[model samples]
Target: MLRLRKSILTVLLAVFTLLGCVAGPSLSAEKTALVVSVPMEGVVGVSLENYLDEAFAYAAEEKAALVVIGLDTPGGLVTSMRGMSQKILSASIPVAVWVGPPGARAASAGAFLVMAAHVAAMAPGTNIGAAHPVTASGQDVPDKELSRKITNDLAAQMRSLAEERGRNAEVAASMVLNSVSLTAREAMEIRVIDTVTPDLPSLLKWADGRKVRVGTVDVVLDLKRYEIRTFEMSPRLRALHFISRPDVAYLMLTLGILAIVFEVLTPGGFVMGTAGAVMALIGAYGLRMLPFNWAGIILLVAGIIVLVLDLVVGGIGVLSLFGLASLVVGSLVLFRAPGGELLNVSVGFMAGITLTLGAFFILAAGAVWRSTRNRVTSGQEGMVQGEGVVVEDLAPGGFVSCHGEVWKAVSEGGERISKGTRVRVVRTDGLLLHVRKVEGENLEEKGAGHK
Candidate 1:
């Protein structure tokens, strides 16, 4: 009986030990992996670069399992694109680029970024490619040799990234060489991308249990128990993005110049001048982010100078008209550079600013011209042609009231002007007025004292 009891106790202990071993790994795996989602929209500039850097840093701090970039850009500066690509390539964790939410494209520089990712994906209705280098104005690169160099360099980059990610390198190079585009299905069929998922959830689900190379080691994504957290741009970054736009920057530059010019012409309250300086500084920051033509800037400055000259020299609207023309031309060419196509300025905004500024300058010119032709109203010369009554009889010289003030006077032709007689001032000699009596008026008809 003792031996049987000992045997049963041993069997029970063995069963419990086996159960503990089976449930141990499952309990440990219950911790959810943090997946960080970063939204990349609009032009890829310094602002976007900064945002991405911050996002990556934050994800690293949180020890995130994966960093997913939700990309939707129409391409942007090449320098910025390269900066962003480097960020992705150097990431500590696995980076996935998803061209998503339908109706989005990964064109130009965006194509390079997508290729740089460890796992590239796209939504059903999305497309990628069209990365041939072009001038800022959207025209073919004018210099054939330079164009070839850029094309080859970009093609090499695309091929290198594709080969590294085990995708079709030749097809990837075609995007830079021929500007060829592909739909989600085409991309999947050609193996240019890993997956074609419709949304974030689908993409995450597909990524589950997939093995990807992180640094030098193969890290299998255990995302079945994953929690996604979206990271957004801070207010400062949002403001930077807003002002980085070519149109917004151009408008700020225009308004700044106008305000400063107005302050210079009026020269009183420094309100316009201060505001103008601030706007100009902000606009200048935007210009630094974009590739701008020097000719356009020169023309814009020249236009403002001409407008100022019109105000100072009081031209008969000719300078104002010329200035308006210069402004229109300058604005049209302001952002026409190698990557200028991405910096799109609205046609309606351009037209409206041109017409409104033209009318304002024309009217201002007219007012200045009219003022120049009119008689002086606030100086020694203003006393001339003013009417007054004599306070004391002018026996050669006497006191008379003119322009609401008493002035010593000498009658013209040295005639005697009686007291209380209304007199007209002919000229001013120092502080004395040269007066002449009205032919039809006497002291009885008019009041003696000036009001």
Candidate 2:
């Protein structure tokens, strides 16, 4: 009885030991290290909001210890930047923004994003700052009052972000007010950035001992053995990112206009017309969202309308020339003032587009003119001297068959005519045809012959 009890105890202990060996390391290991790399390689638009949303969702789901944002950007829209900064500030996980991979920069809006992170870091050869705001066309905005107001608002926001993250608030504010910039080492020295790491390994190693506050509780980071999970933008976000580019928007606008023009030229094709309408609506929507000059849009529309009118009403090329000039001017003024890193359609692009559209319209007008000048082929005027057969009897008037159809006919010399008698068409009035006796056959002779 003692041996049996001892054997059962030994079996239970061995089974418990095997279970521990199988699950102990995994149970003790931390599984919530999320690294969100936001490589903002293009113009910042409303799409950044979607990308930030995706990153935050991933962090929340993983209950991540730290969320690292690997940044490389030339900055973007001020509104988008500010929105992203606010999101970073309100995130539950500790957010670390690392400007990385040698020669990367956090300029303009990027500067604000970097400063807002809980732990701001930089890889070697990275730079931060340069927060100048400008228009889409690379022109500096001239409204002093409005500019001042915007500057103050951005400065306050940056100050608050820096203060909350324990970074240098003065330097952060200077980035907006003075457009100051710094290297990775310089940023760390001035306390603008928390650390300057050479690579991801070094970044994770440095982040291990850092203390980050989540809500009201302070959590000591244990990132040394953490699993790094990366989150990416969804298909919808990716598509938005592509379409938000300045070149893409410009191209869409041009194509939409061209499609509408083609649809107008050939009416009754509802498919083409509907497609044109849809494309134009979408293009207009994108344009409204961008910084554009309303006057330019109006002028562009007027130019197109004038050119179309030239096609409808013969203008001898005068209206066409005026329309071309309007198009050129409108293209130049399309985008409002620009000076920031926002995508801008260049003057050269505008010139190219205008020239192409003008040339197409001119060619189309020439084709229409040629078609109008073509000679008639099948009408009463086309049948002068053609033969006809009498279809009804008449005394000075009758019916004749001509061109496979019947027509009312009258004798030219006030002579009687009979049915089945052949005659020559001498003149016409509306649907009435005046006829003469056949050659070598007088009217009386034709009547006798018919009898």
The best candidate by lDDT is 1
Worst 10 residues of 2 by lDDT: 337-346
Residue-level lDDT of model 1, residues 57-116, one tens digit each, is 999999999999999887788778888988888889999999987999888888888999
Per-residue CA lDDT of candidate 2, range 1-451, in tens?
9999999999999999999998888777655455554555555567777788887887788677778878887777676776788788888888888888888888878888898888889988989987755555555457887678777887898899898888899998998788898999999999999999987778889889678876677877877676676677778877777766555666677667767876888687778777767767766766654566777777787888777777877555567788888877777667663323333345566677788878877877777777678764479875567678777775788788888888888988888877666788888887888887665554445677789
* Pairs of residues clashing in candidate 2: 135-338, 137-338, 138-338, 138-339, 139-338
**Once model 1 is optimally superposed onto the true structure by TM-score, how far is the C-alpha of residue 418 displaced, in angstroms?**
2.1
Give the Cα RMSD of candidate 2: 7.5
TM-scores across all candidates? 0.83, 0.69
Q: Which candidate ranks first by TM-score, i.e. highest? A: 1
